[model samples]
Target: MQRHSLSVSELTEPDVVRRALDALCREVDGEAAVAKTALRKRSAFSEVLGAAVGKGYFAENPLARVKWQAPGVSEEVDPACVPNPTQVACLLTAVGRQRGRGPHLEAFFGCMYYAAMRPAEVIHLQISQCHLPKSGWGMFNLSGGVVTAGKEWTDDGAVHEVDSLKR
Candidate 1:
């Protein structure tokens, strides 16, 4: 009775692979999920299959041979969604008008808009990094940032993860 479940050969079979792909397609259909989100899941799975191929466990990644079609990903940026400089300034001022921490948050949002810093990068920015000048220009020395990567992937089981600036 215990020997029936072991069938590693079936993993590479075309029919079995197709059936699994079909099931995955059906399961993730609808529910407000985007095509990119679903494709990312497949890509993550492909990495594991790639490792199996490297270890000589298989001829190649099963995913590489399988004919699975992912939905089209749009790379274009919509100009209509982008706010003008004046619009951004006004929005920042409006946030400052709010009670309590709103005024403090305006500068935080400003750095994201003007300096092009990510939310995580802005959060970790310290006063020591600032090169604030009285006149012309100033700069910041950004070394690293923190982001949310979910608790399961982190060593401390915390949702936030620290990462160096990319690019």
Candidate 2:
């Protein structure tokens, strides 16, 4: 609004929204914004514009006609960075060798590696949730996990909050 000297009413045009998106693509660091950041910003803009239309501030959402495309993003993991069985065994052995908290952490790390459980899930795991047999495969009935959001964000003002698994 400040850059174009336009109010919310004037922003109901497709061209104006496109130009605003173009400006958003350029970052303060003189580099193009990442695809994820641009996508999230575009979603936020679309949501606000949609609300404005619902409130009769505009006849329609200008962003609906905008054709701005964010840059491509890759979500692939590098296999070389992942540890193999032998390396993981060595790391676990080292952890178990430590005196104080090491023994406790060794089992935690084992759960993360063997069951593919996240740290928060392992921290919140209960014995009843695990179905281990004398000499066979074991099962884990995962119910919830711990989230370490700041105390201010939680209802009880605790640093960690128990929440169901994310989608």
Candidate 3:
């Protein structure tokens, strides 16, 4: 019960579809898309092609014949991209050299490097929670962080809401 001609065309070619999908697999910076994102796009495209076939626009799903696979996800970070302590110190120093906001952010970045605190946690840090002394080292009693959500998505209509620290 097909309404359209069965002739193959450039738009529906399997090779063309494969190439377009391959392009989608890589980001603009040439990095591969995350596994979950790529897989979701693939599934969505497949459904679209299935609908086209069901409506008699295509003879079959072209992607069904492609053998390409998405890149695997990994938790291991590349060591080369990691900055050493000296590099971090130099970066913090450079940040502190900026005119207006630099001096303020120097301590913020220091908390991230020295205490290994997340940006959110540092954002929510209070002066009262700091145990700074006239001595060697100081301590911070971190409680939670501030999470930004859309106003419509929040119960109180505030964009920034206090949330517990992530485990």
Candidate 4:
């Protein structure tokens, strides 16, 4: 295996850090994948750098010195990609008809459309966290979630066990 050594002092310059990140972006797969991976890498690197600076390893975080400019994102939603009311109705009807199947899927859609939830947030919901009454007009306490961690068949080693919603 090849070992790479990067000194903190070398990454202190804005230009140096920018160049390193640019190189990383080029090495990534596609444009979308590159952007996503680069952003995550940049965030993780910044966090580590911040901790190192606080521990007196460096006077300041080098990553903080650089001003990153993200590429322009399309603000307009694609018409073809956006589902119509009819399509949505069909999906909801199908989901409602899926008896004996996982109720999580149907409930997830309801939470998303009616309760305004993100798909990731819905997937993490537990039965214990919900409080839907018999009246079906009450709120649910979405606290935590369980995610698939490989093929373990258990709720062990899942990433990001959050205690609160992003809001």
Candidate 5:
């Protein structure tokens, strides 16, 4: 719920509020299937709590006082999951061979390799955004890109939608 309209003076006591926050943390912990899941949720919850306190809905953020420790989990990206140079080349070759593939796809891969563009940015590219010179090699205008929330696609996730490349 939005915190702007909430009034701490009319709400429950500070101790009661603290206890409620504690209960919510416990509930989140219990429902979370993984430590990372719990950690992420708690992090966002803490932000909301902070906002509530800032709006004078509460004297202090109870979440600030509580110590949250997430259990250890592997944070490292798996080496096997990453594509080697040869694999990448083969994939690129395959993408190049697809029938009726537009120049955009080739340019997109070029951006991925040369400009180190993320996939979302490549997909959102427009033809008019590129700056191919009349004499020299072309250059891509990648001032915009898409980003997913929490490493997965969601309906409510934000995407950088650009109508035109910036001049």
Candidate 6:
């Protein structure tokens, strides 16, 4: 069998680095895939590049030395998506009216909108964690959340995987 792999010289080339950055900015699978590739993706690629430097494969990270303009992206949230207090109240009332899971999901949505909780955090919330005071503000701990990474990725062969809160 024949094997093909990129050599260290080919990997650190200017064209290869530019191609990767271009891919990050370009749409994939007919959808605009977002990436702050430097910060997000756990900086895995950067770490790899650093390893290359340590191994004397390169003098420096080629991507850092080069200057390129990424596509303009708005970081602000659109005002149209936000609901007013009155609208939120109306929505809550309507949610309570629906049958079965609606009543349960209303509180879930409240945690998302009011507390700005992630869905995973809401799902793993335990009643014991809540300190519901008689009058004033109550409190709860958000230690972690469960993620569904599918059976293939989990040790127990179950879909749900418990993980620490995101940074």
Q: Write the per-residue lDDT of candidate 5 for residues 1-167, one digit (tens) a residue.
A: 66645554533454654544444444444652455555666678678778877887778766655544665545677989977778877777777777787445665686787667677777776788788788877777766655445424455543433333322
Report the lDDT tens digits of candidate 2 across residue range 1-167.
58848888768677888877877776888688777688788888889888998999988788866677776755677989989999999999999999999988998999999899988889899999999999977999888899899999999999999989754
Which consecutive 10 residues in model 6 have the weakest lDDT in total?
33-42
TM-score, candidate number 1: 0.56
- List lDDT for all candidates, in order: 0.78, 0.86, 0.85, 0.69, 0.62, 0.76
Error of 1 at 93 (Å): 1.9
Q: Each prediction's TM-score against the native?
A: 0.56, 0.69, 0.54, 0.51, 0.42, 0.65
In what order do the candidates fall by TM-score, top score first? 2, 6, 1, 3, 4, 5
The list of candidate 1 runs beyond 4 A from truth reads 1-74, 149-153, 157-159
Candidate 2: deviation at residue 148, Å? 1.7
| Per-residue lDDT of model 1, residues 1-167, tens digit only | 55855365677987776665544443454343356666676777778778877888889888767787764545677889989899999999999999998987998998898888998998888999988899966898998898988999999999998899976
Candidate 6 stretches with Cα past 4 Å from truth are: 1-36, 40-74
Q: Model 5, residue 27: displacement in angstroms? A: 11
The lDDT of model 6 is 0.76
Error of 4 at 107 (Å): 3.1
Write one digit per residue (lDDT tens) for candidate 3, span 67-116. 88877777687979988999999999999999999987998999998999
Question: Which stretches in model 2 have alpha-carbon errors above 4 Å?
Answer: 1-40, 51-57, 63-74
List candidate 3 segments past 4 Å from native: 1-74
Q: Candidate 5 — which pairs collide?
A: none
**Tens-place lDDT digits, model 4, residues 1-167:** 22576676778778888877666555445444345666777777778889988999889888766877644334567889967778876787788788776365666787787777777678777667677788857676776544444545435554544444665
What lDDT does candidate 6 reach at residue 118? 94
